[model samples]
Target: MPACEITIEKIDFEEPIHIVRITGALDAYSFPDFEIKVRDIFEKSGRNIILDFGKLDYISSAGLGALMGFAKIARQNNGDLIILKPTPKIGSIIDVLGLSKFIKVFWDEKTALNSFVSKAG
Candidate 1:
């Protein structure tokens, strides 16, 4: 198990999006904590979320499954889970799994934030 850190930051956008920065490796070992923190945030407000993968080094199938679960919950509440600035390796994995079809990925933070507004309008 590698060092995994999940930090949740509230971005001051017009709609108030939550940016969850994932660092290090996200595998089965760390998925539990990640899921708890994210679910707590979602339960509090059910706001749109952006998973910032800029510092994330790796992810496993279990990690992806957790994300898919989050995405489903967000959608049910009229919110969404977006992926921001994924590393090339992580990006490839996500693409290969066709996760992009359900979760939107953005290269830029501003773009990802705007997507929430665009969808609401």
Candidate 2:
């Protein structure tokens, strides 16, 4: 199985948004790959990000910490990072740890995408 896989699809908005889908396990060993993928997006000045974690089966504290940092970066750039369709395990951790307050979680893709529009408008 892959340690971690990240696929980005760009959605054209007023400023464009990226839907980043994560699969496999996101642990210490795979954190660098994840960081690279996201850092590249920020480097291009793309801020709106939706992280689809439905296919991700495992995530360590390192992964969560990385996410927090990315969220901050996105927000600082007039955009934000949201979570989409996270599994129950991931959802529970986000809720219990109060990450949900910092990150919005949506089960529907349309709603998640629209949220960025609403924020921008």
Candidate 3:
């Protein structure tokens, strides 16, 4: 399988939210490709994003830093990056790195979507 597979879904609410589904491992090798895709999303004015890690098998420090970078850019645009359904191993790593405090993590899609709405209001 590919080092990483990324799929983006745009949901149009008051402010559009892009759901980016990633699979496989997001490490140093795959981070460049993923970063390229993310730049495309930013070009399209995709500010708010949901990172669906449900199928993600692994993530490296590079991937985690990219997440932080994405979140910062989104936040600058008055939006944010939210994590969805990360695997236990990924969750453990995120917690260990103290990333969860920086980014929001949710198990349910509805809740995650509503979080953006709630932030706007």
Candidate 4:
């Protein structure tokens, strides 16, 4: 049997932005863990964020709820959240939910990260 695992990690950027890379399934069982980790990081930094979904395999409604919660928190702090490298399946899910209207999606990390600078005052 294969070892089942889900992982999330935070990588700090230069300033006012951070990347949260998530991998594996993000269903109800794992959403809370991902939510907690992300919330804790945001509570401390409260900066712009990039959610890197390059390696993420799946997500359920609970996972989407968790992401919405984090988006609210980011917005409350005047920070923005973007997503990067989502697979077509995930991208379609996001589109169906109309989340793409509120959250920007990028095909590359550099472009996603650069948006903050270009849009800055």
lDDT of 1: 0.89
Better of 1 and 2 by TM-score: 2
Listed per model in order, the count of residue pairs whose N, CA or C atoms clash below 3 Å is 0, 0, 0, 0
**Cα lDDT listed for each candidate:** 0.89, 0.90, 0.90, 0.77
Instruction: List the lowest-lDDT window of 10 residues for candidate 4.
Output: 1-10
Preferred candidate (TM-score higher): 2 or 4: 2
Tens-place lDDT per residue, model 3, 3-71, is 788998999999898899999989888888888888788878888889999999988887898799888
RMSD of 4: 2.6
Using Cα atoms with residue i matched to residue i, what is each candidate's TM-score against the true structure? 0.93, 0.95, 0.93, 0.84
lDDT by residue (tens digit), candidate 1, 13-57: 566789999999988788889889888888888569999999999
lDDT for model 2 comes to: 0.90
* Best of the candidates, lDDT: 2
**How far in Å is the alpha carbon of 109 misplaced in model 2?**
0.6
What lDDT score goes with residue 104 in model 4?
86
TM-score, cand. 2 vs. native: 0.95
Task: Determine the backbone clash count of candidate 1.
Answer: 0
